[model samples]
Target: MPTTKKESLQFGLMMCFGMVLFMTIYNLFLSGFIEAITLMEVIKEFIIGFLIALTLDIFLVGPGVKKIVSKLPIDKSKKINMVLAMSTLMVLAMALFMSVFGLAISYLHNGNEDNSLLKDYFSTFLKNFIVAYPLQLIVMGPLVRYLFIKFVLKIKCNCNEY
Candidate 1:
């Protein structure tokens, strides 16, 4: 989808921002902060999460997903196939890595006294993947693509162009 380096960066930033914002809220709710969540708190968590997620996405997940998608037997000529494969893999990888980051932060702050680090990590990963997969595939992916094309690329529709 992104043909240029600048477009790639833009796309990544947009995706990371949306994903981090939603996921942070979802995670806070999961942790029973439903009524207690503050805007400033969400902003703080989103900032930290966004930085880490963007770094992981650019350096690791993006390249690794591309590599994995390339090796898949799906038809490369079909843009839909490529897009689906890439999105699925990217979501999977990001969810996996971010889950670990989340657990580390939780442990650092709360201190894992139950010795259930492994269990908690897996549970977190599963819960994150469940929500993240659909959130990306159904919502964020299409939304980001449309925004990038409309705003970043400045592509006008024929119906609206005078």
Candidate 2:
């Protein structure tokens, strides 16, 4: 979604905010939030997740997807179609990386390490990706992109014009 470092940073910040919110709620839900999740816990998760999301998206996945997606035989003449395609790719890439970040945060929070770290982490990644993909594509992705386009970048795309 971002072609430059400055845009990437802004995009990353938006994504980090959205994703951390989603993951915090999802993780707590899985752990049975009925047991009471604390404000401090949420804060910690947000901090760690934000850092991970920002770093991974900006440096690794964001640029990689840009190059790869640009080569795809998509109907790029239409901005809406291009945006949708990019959003899908971004979600998938972000989910993949979320596995590593989730595992680390879980370990840090609980201070409990699994013997089968690799296996467990892979499983965690897969589960997270499944849920995150849809949430990003349908909700957070568009919202963040819109905000970026309007407020941050302030560039109105001509995609909707014939």
**What is every candidate's alpha-carbon RMSD to the true fold?**
3.2, 4.7
lDDT of 2 by residue, 1-162 (tens): 566777778778887798778887787676555256678877877787788778777788877888887999988899877777777787777777777777776676565554588787778777887888788878887898889888766553454343
Q: Rate the local accuracy (lDDT) of all candidates.
A: 0.86, 0.76
Looking at model 2, the pairs that clash are none
Candidate no. 2 TM-score: 0.77
For candidate 2, give the lDDT of residue 51: 83
Pairs with backbone N, CA or C atoms under 3 Å apart (clashes), candidate 1: none
Q: What lDDT is reached at residue 145 by model 1?
A: 94
Residue 133 displacement (Å), model 1: 0.4
Candidate 1 off by > 4 Å: 34-38, 108-110, 113-115, 155-162
